[model samples]
Target: METTFDAADFHQTKLQNQLIQQLAAVEAQSNSTWATQQGQNSTRLAIALNLI
Candidate 1:
């Protein structure tokens, strides 16, 4: 009985850790995408200004 409970707890902890890692990865990817978009917009604006 004790062993079973321990195993369940370990499994739960492992799943939680995996979930946190996945969320962090997603957040990082989102930030990277946003940064890339911002950089592109800035470049376009600079080009437009130069055209004027």
Candidate 2:
């Protein structure tokens, strides 16, 4: 019984680690996309101001 419990606990911990890693990856991707969008927007603004 103890062995079975240990196995289950280990499996649960492994799954939790995987979920955390996946979440971190998603957050990083979102941040990169937001940064890119901000850069593009500022570039457009700069061009518009120069034209004016």
Candidate 3:
């Protein structure tokens, strides 16, 4: 015998996948922004220390 799948279950799964993808994208953007800020800070510190 074969089992049947429900439409609601499929829809819920799709929605969860979409949310996961969106969260991953947001995380990547945040990390990129943080790295950029760190680089800028390092540069400023170097200039202040007269090491650049």
Candidate 4:
């Protein structure tokens, strides 16, 4: 019985860690995508101003 409880706790901890890692990865990806978009917009604005 003790072994079973220990195994369950270990599994829960592992799952929690996995979820946290996944969330961090997703947040990083979103931040990167947002930065890229901002860079592109800045470039376009610069180009438009130069054209005028």
Q: What lDDT score is found at residue 26 in candidate 4?
A: 100
lDDT of 4 at 45: 100
RMSD of each: 3.3, 3.0, 2.5, 3.4
lDDT of 1 by residue, 1-52 (tens): 3445677798999999999999999999999999999999999999999999
Model 4: residues with Cα > 4 Å off, grouped in runs: 1-5
Compared with the true structure, what per-residue lDDT tens digits does model 4 show for residues 1-52?
3445677798999999999999999999999999999999999999999999
Global fold similarity of model 2 (TM-score):
0.87
If the candidates were sorted by their TM-score against the true structure, best first, what order would they fall in?
A: 1, 4, 2, 3
- Model 3, position 47: C-alpha lDDT score: 95
Off by over 4 Å in 1: 1-5
lDDT of 3 by residue, 1-52 (tens): 7577789889999999999999999999999999999999999998999964
Cα error, residue 20 of model 4, in Å, equals 0.3
Residue pair clashes in candidate 2: none
Against the true structure, candidate 3 reaches a TM-score of 0.83
Judge candidate 4 against the unseen true structure and give its global Cα lDDT, from 0 to 1. 0.95
